[model samples]
Target: MLKNLAHAHTQKFGKGFNVCNLNNMRAFFLAFSIWNALRSKLSWTHYRSFAG
Candidate 1:
């Protein structure tokens, strides 16, 4: 399912939709499932680091 989703996203968006990236995105979403819990002052890099 991820492979198919990634392929379709790549076909439409043209880049940055590989399996590894999809997995990272899934992990990020799982880690931060609560939108209200996210800190607005933090950058994406900070959030990514936290997710990692």
Candidate 2:
């Protein structure tokens, strides 16, 4: 499913939809599953660091 989604995303968006990025995105989503639990002042990189 992730492979298919990655292919479609690349076709539509042209780049940055590889399996590794998709996996990281999934991890980020799982880590921050609660929308309100996110800190408003933190950037995505910061969140990514925390998630990692």
lDDT of 1 at 32: 95
Candidate 2 lDDT by residue in tens digits, 9-50:
999998999999999999999999999988899998998998
Per-residue CA lDDT of candidate 1, range 1-52, in tens? 9999999999999999999999999988999999899989998899799999
Off by over 4 Å in 1: none
The TM-score between candidate 1 and the true structure equals: 0.81
Every model: Cα RMSD to truth: 1.2, 1.3
lDDT of 1: 0.93
Return the clash pairs for model 2, or none. Answer: none
TM-score per candidate: 0.81, 0.79
Cα-based lDDT for every prediction: 0.93, 0.94
| Cα error of candidate 2 at position 52, Å | 1.4
Q: Which stretches of candidate 2 lie over 4 Å from their true place?
A: none
In angstroms, how far off is 8's CA in candidate 1? 0.5
